[model samples]
Target chain A: MNLSRRDALAALAATGVVAGGSVALADDGTDGNVDPADGVPENVIGDDTVAILAAVGSVVYPDATTGIDPFVETYVSGRLSDDPDHRRGVVDAAAELDATARDWFDAPVTELDRSTCDRLLRELGVDAVDPDPEGSLSGRVRFYIVNELLYAFYSSPTGGRLVGIENPVGYPGGTESYRRASMGEETEHGRE
Target chain B: MAGSDRTPAPPADVCIVGAGPAGAIVAARLAEAGHDVVVLDAGPRYEPENRERQLDAHLRPGMEGPWGTGGERDAYTSSGERHYPLNAARVKGIGGSTLHWQAMVMRLHERDFEMDSRHGVGADWPVDYADLRPYYAAAERELGVAGADDNPFAPPREKPFPLPAFPPSHSDSIFAEACEALGLPTHSVPNARNSEPTDDASACVGYGTCKPVCPSGAKYTAERHVARAETAGARVVDRAPVQRLVHDETAVDAAVYATPDGEQHRQEARAVVLACGGVENVRLLLLSASDAYPDGLANSSGLVGRYFMDHCFAGVGGRIDRPTRQNHVGFNTTECHALYDGTDPLAGVKLEFLNYAGPSPAIDALHADEWGDDLLDSLRDSYGTHLAVGGLVEQFPDADNRITLDRSTTDDHGNPVPDVEWSVGPETRRAIERANEVQRAILEELDADIDWIVGPDETGPAYHHMGTTRMGTDPGSSVVAPDCRAHDLDNLWIAGSSVFPTGGGMNPTLTIAALSCRLADRLDRWL
Candidate 1:
């Protein structure tokens, strides 16, 4: 079934009925309980970025098609709470990328355009390319976004199959036992 | 494959990359046979006459982070994303992985070589046990390993051990007694550390930190062989990553490398031997994708980054019911238990009672998660009383499990880093479950009520990734032939565990070392 506004409304009604007013909200990727319309979460990924993600991630990650929660969660986690070093290199190309993300969105990146989003991301240094450490912050953020998107993509079954990694599968090898060694007993000098 | 007869860069008779044991062996043998040899390594040039660490970056497990030890957590691809050929951390120094490895040299049983035919699974190595037996002996001699030579499962050898086995540590004796009590035979283990000096390096003092960089240089590494090759006039370039294996579809012409300064330079050779390792070797092949062979250089079968394997490992630790002190005779006994019954009908898991290093504080904290204050008091009361049994499972070959390069993700060198996509299959899970049952049974033998049992965790990565560029007789099915020469490209050879089609639940260093020796003799023919 298509996830229409009617379906969203019905789900929202159910959530509201199930839990009083403090139902956990994912308006901008925050884990806390908050109302989506009232206000946004602290450091939310933003509406436009989320829309772009829903688009790019849908193509990039197979998990998006099946709606696997863990991979999605990891992707969001990588974006909002990732280390600076993990950011996308596009942020390094700085001005050029920021403008493209905005132009691609046809507005501010806060309301990005999904169709031309990845292309803009590539221009900003999202895909594999020479790393530009010159532009630090935005570049780092872009890198993080890219990282999360890729992680989710691989975590998906399709991504896993294409890459040849057997995720959620059984052992590829066998096991055995033999005697070896370990640390010595602790003594007055020190633990062996 | 660049589709041009653009003469190979910096021409020489032979060019070998990475001055590790594998690389050093190939270079030394070729150079001694009067070939103009050049070996490129990404480590400081170590002069045997006078050794000093000039910008050495050796990273071992215990010494976390990229500080004193030369290991780095910067291996993740720059796609700002996932990187595979995942978890392979090599020392850029002259010695390679040997710099931080425990010098426990052991070979796969005869059954390991023919695991495919015997078990109807995995792929059989192109060469048989008999083909590698002599090479194993040669590698052991060169490394100066100390063993009892009485191991029932150990491959046969002509050379008597250079020295006796290192005296068992306090924990070793306890293991022997327990194994014997349980009707299991135990013997002293073979090690590369000398009780006395083999030549330049010192002997083992049992410092208990073998995983980190060895300060005494007692451990056998490519550093020694590199020195020998250097003495024989073989020039080794350090801090250079061989970017491409400059080759056409039919022949390996030369090697293209990026210098430490990031300047690109090409070094040509009549023959190029690859000992870069299972992960990097295959990755470098995939990345050098050219027109003559669009899939990848020397990748006729498209198997460059496929069939990745790691020995499945998990702990079997139990708290002593009562107060008991555990000590050592030393490390791995000559003989172990009846678990690794490769020849028996009851064989399922490859069992070895290892004397593993102490658990990290993080692991201990996890183990002592419950019981709060009582846990602290209990820990203090029974510290060394905990006995851990480790088992190595054969990581069978699966084409779906591999070391593929993430074209979308680049590395520090502006090159695509490997994005490892690994997860166990049903067969692996079944094996783990079966082996875990055995581990639990053995732990029960120690005490009545099991105190703490730890098996496979959710998120774990394997350090020993093997079988990516697997060896086989058929050029159609494998990347390299039995002699480790690339099936698609003549004179392009590889040495190390990367050639292994199937691993029999054991360490790959000895087998790699033996293969290096074998490749040396093969390269000596120089047809």
Candidate 2:
């Protein structure tokens, strides 16, 4: 049977996800191993939620040289620990994606093949899996998934290299040296 | 240094509150003239070693420092018909707001002094621009201003700038071409930053982070003057916030301030100069109610906290067809003032090209759904090609847009916080609309694709606070007289933008410094 939006929400609630509240992991037998270097606390969000964000981020930022999985994991874990609204949105989106996968592929979203996951994401529009009807599903994904990835990429030294600026502000490239250009030869009536 | 340790306050020939640009200048001059001068600042002192960490903190998103504390968090409340984010715009260190200023120092137009005669709006200053011209020259020399000598837009001056104008950057080239095609005139902006290495400050190396903190001492901050004041035999006390003015019927007798440890002390002086910023100056005055004056200390005219004004600012940007390698450069290197003296019914506008080498974060926020190859391509196309232009529109002083004490909310020291009530008038709105139209036309001339244009209604803070305790010929309507002395008090003086009767289309720092120098000369004779 297909899972309705209400059924998906109820499944999330059953797993300890409350509306406008902190999300607790469902313990679906996945090890919640924490990497101290990643700067995210363990068991803040489910491994499944991190996997869902990774899948969406890979499709969204397909051109990234360093794959989006690690970025997604770090960003999601950090935001889930810091902001409650972020946790709620992420948990609900993961639940909705799992419910849709069950209805279509008869398995959890993280267990689906890459090709099937890509096709399913394409079929469901960016705004299709909105957990909160009042808010945009696409916007939630953009903020919780897409925006964080873009910020990480663009603010990096690699991203600055792509844009042709050396050591952009807010980065650790200390103290630059460059010659100031002149406004061309000044005409009698100012620069022509 | 007047050490932070709580000692009995000493008697002085001159006691200046707030060791910012104005207070530092006055204190330095008075001490040089052999007067016993002591200056007190409400914020802590910062050294060069603190610059790198503060710069990093400032550049990080959502980690900017608070007003008084160096990097500590603090908050103040504001409630009125209009809510102004007063905390974001103000700083309270010994060097004051100059610590975070971009240092675009241009003289006020001559017409800015004669607003009543020329525009039929606002009060005219008791002294005109010509009266201030010599002191302006002195201030330029002291602060190391760099500008082109032959620029036609500047007011007539007898002496040239001390340093040559900074060479334009890639963004300046782009802006110049567009301005030329549009029949607009462009000029090298006058800046307080050093173009060449001087003995005191280094030449600007284009770090592109001048607003929050200057990594190098390339741009002038008021702390240099505070250091000079200390070297010239003036004592400075930090983290000393003044609470009230102890006054008699004729003059201010002493300034009572509280230390960080909550101990109160009083510094007695023959003359007291209030050099705190525009909002805080008025708040201090309104808080100093006594038996002689029930309303406030300087409220005999009931105009202590009236006539607040700030420049109306609007931002517009577009993406150009050609890419330029102009991402990290000194900001405000070029400007166009052709629209400054227009025939339009609204006030004039000054358009400055914001030279940053990155895509607009506001635009990034809108494209949250974009990802993958599409995102990369879009970033490449928009990154170096994006150009932002901002317009600074003149706002006439309105008596209604004022700052009052919010008695319900108190600071950590239990004083009433300042509540700012400010709004743009119809003339400012019309001027902003016209400025946006001009910006779009310039972008079109450059064959650029328009990204977004924010109108006057969507304008943000310019942070040029002025006109609270205005100077005027009439004591009934203004707080200060021709020499910035309190109209009712014999020995109470004010320095800074708080005394500006009408704010011009340019930045007000140089003028504030000039007025402080002039006030020092006047006080030297009176003392």
Candidate 3:
């Protein structure tokens, strides 16, 4: 997690993916290169796992988040690249999800339509179960897949603004901004 | 005998143990006074550049490595009635706990000094508030305390604080309205954080991560004093934990400490000052047992590790309709000490209006059962609407609630670790319940939906360790005398909250600094 933006860029280059490289890798599933959205090297997590995670983010995230695919891909790659133990758990969960999708729809989760993917996740009991990394299959999926995507989205500056938390805990915008009573215009979207 | 093979270091005029606020101030003053001082600390000097990474560690789920304190070196045993998370709020680094402290630095009340005489419960401190008034002012200037003379309940001060007070947060303003309705007084809490730019550190930029890490240099850590001590020509030895005090019946000879190279060295000094905090102070004394004093050096009363005390925390939090702008400012700005000065037996409660309350939007969203728009809605409803009141209540010292050597378990150095057996009696429980009642009234005045409440049974320590090596006039019942010198040993002295006779309701760091200053002046005169 302490890996700087420059370090991340270097890591991406080391994995044969350069910054602003190409969308061809994302378009064609055959190539090992990931989508050059955030320049998070796909070598940490596989392209198929990234694709399924992106699809899952679409189902869980608000419909307004049209950029969820790139956002999730970038977030997951960054998240998985931090700790090896956590990466193994997340990777295993993604594989479990892909296997479940193939068993039900006779195809991978990324190939399924949006509505079918949503139904499939709910049917797998991810929506009903509590997120536990060491719990059942549904719990692991909810924890490593669903919860991970949600954490990535909400903790981001853009996603935090969607719910009126302009300056989240991790991001230090500045000092004097807290003197203001509210985020003002930004609070309107989250307000009832 | 441990470090007998190694050549003893050149003798210093004074040798201080622990580089915390207590030891730092003592060393700085002594070194500035042209005395040769050497300070031995158990931890490393953390770099300021790593604060961003420390903040990231705090932000991560489960808050791993926030203070970077753990593993074998920082190990201890807790056998309390209520399980004490010993490492929860401690930083063993060069600056000590001040590196991650919230920086609230209020003076102890006059009543806190005369607790036994007035309340007939805890023992009275040998030195009263009047004795420490000058030192209190000096400590405030030393730490750059920012405050307003608004608290009607506060003890009389000679002058205004060094810096102006930080403005009350938006949530504190909201809570102020409720407090006004309940006839409770509210005022800006005194903070060691800079309100404006000082010579040493910058003005607080409200990084909002004051507890685990302060990204900005505005917050005062004891590192400033340590730096000053070093600049004043005090030799500071970090990663050199003092193993034991080499002592005699009438006086102390030297301090034996262990270094990283797996070698022990004897640091000979004319005078020794133990400033290793409440728990370790006792542990070091007990570990220094010799043929001359089997009950521990300067512990003829057998009270070296007795009368351990800490402040118990109580809180009540609930959600309101609109945004309270929670966590906009990391530190609390408002507090009420009315209950602390009251005549009631359950009066030692100091209430704080927490600026940060409830969980972050990320946490709420992550834990939500709903995924899509419903999760977003839940986050909006729960994110910033939280308002909470926290209280710090005093725990009177009990002989049974003490720290002893856990010889059964060895530390990374293969030495016996400190075994903490802490427990709060009925008085503490009553005080916490009383605090919750006042907190509930303030929250209910705002028509908040009462959700969570931390009553007596659920309360935890504020980590203000006190009264282990208690200071009193009597040698029969106390370890140190009124001047913070050992009752048994002539040349040895104690610093920090470990010498406190009673644990007051306020934050102890300011008081700890004040006492350290007083001890320095005393030691200077003696030397």
| Superposition error at B118 for model 1 (Å) | 1.5
How much native contact recovery, as a fraction, does model 2 achieve? 0.22
Error of 1 at B6 (Å): 22
- Candidate 1 residue-wise lDDT at B364: 32
Predicted model with the maximum DockQ? 3
DockQ of each: 0.01, 0.11, 0.26
Q: In every candidate, what fraction of the native interface contacts is reproduced?
A: 0.00, 0.22, 0.46
Model 2, B154-250: lDDT tens per residue? 7889887889887666777888898988888888888998888898888875556677677677888888888888898888888888889999888
The positional error of residue A155 in candidate 2, measured at the CA in angstroms, is 7.2
Chain B TM-score, candidates in order: 0.85, 0.94, 0.96
Best by TM-score: 3
lDDT of 3 by residue, B123-241 (tens): 99998999999999999998999999999988889899999999887788888899888888899999999889999888876556788788776899999998898888888888888
Which sequence of candidate numbers ranks them by DockQ, best first? 3, 2, 1
Q: For model 3, which pairs clash?
A: A175-B205
Off by over 4 Å in 1: A1-192, B1-10, B43-74, B77-89, B321-337, B343-348, B354-382, B448-462
Listed for every candidate in order, the interface RMSD values in angstroms are 20.8, 9.4, 5.4
CA lDDT scores, all candidates in order: 0.56, 0.72, 0.80
Would you give me the overall lDDT of model 3?
0.80
Candidate ranking (TM-score, best to worst): 3, 2, 1
